[model samples]
Target: MIGLLSTTFGVSVASALLPLISVELFAIGLVLKEPEIPWWVLALVIATGQIGGKLLHYYAARGAIRLPRFLRREKSGKSSPGRWRAWLESFRENCRNRPVWAGSVLLISAVASLPPFAAVAVIAGWAKVPVSTFLITGFIGRFARFGVLAAAPAAMATWL
Candidate 1:
């Protein structure tokens, strides 16, 4: 059980940090292999791992940590801002105007991955959303998401 939990947490964190990895699929497989592990326990472990991994991006976006040169955005010396920069500026302004909506978007992305949770985490931090708010909403949303995902295999087995 300890080994399974550790593996779950490791995979969850790795998936969170790497866009190519899919924690959702991993959770499904884990459930199929270890039905004895409680679904909620799996959910909590995954949520903690994911949020912990994403916290690095949040901290970087919030300027608590500096990104290395490769990850940092290069300044465009052009007289006018580029299209992406302009759009980002506009989006930042909108987030500033409606704080609740910003938080809602973060929660929605965490659960549904509509806009991609990785980007949302950075955006949430860049927009100055409180760290406490980010962690609370992120964990709740991830917990809910993984809870359903981890239970899917058992649900399917019973139905079959």
Candidate 2:
């Protein structure tokens, strides 16, 4: 659990630094003038960072708040555990016992993948998703995203 939290913190920081990292990698000649990081490395980095963030989100949600706490920065502060719990309560009537929780977790993760609301990591944490599952899913999703980013320029360069 502690490891997951730390990993997530590292991942979040990495995501925040992605633009600068790209430039540095380019300048360092790790990424050539062709203007793309290698697909495998890009996928690995994205997966590591995103999964780490998601794990951190889960731990944060699971950690009950205490008074007079000092945090480095505020959380994403969008939909929190409180909000999610309330929503679950209201929807409990129509929800079955088994599928509801897991389904909601996956659904939230999938939804978070969309733009302007990248909350998969946070949502997965709030939903108490298994760390293994979160990491696996995150890896797959991040790989797909990075693969697209890496491929775009190469594909277009072929035409040019």
lDDT (10s digit) by residue, model 1, range 1-160 = 9998999899989998898988888888888887999999999999999999999889998899988899888976789888987987777887889878877887899899889899989887787788887898899999999998988788888999
Off by over 4 Å in 1: none
Candidate lDDT scores, in order, read 0.88, 0.49
Candidate 2 — which pairs collide? 8-52, 58-125
lDDT tens digits, residues 42-70, model 2? 54554566555445555665464332457
List residue ranges in candidate 2 displaced over 4 A.
Answer: 1-13, 16-37, 64-85, 88-112, 115-118
The lDDT, on a scale of 0 to 1, for candidate 2 is: 0.49
Q: Worst 10-residue stretch by lDDT in candidate 2?
A: 22-31
Query: Which residue pairs collide, candidate 1?
Result: none
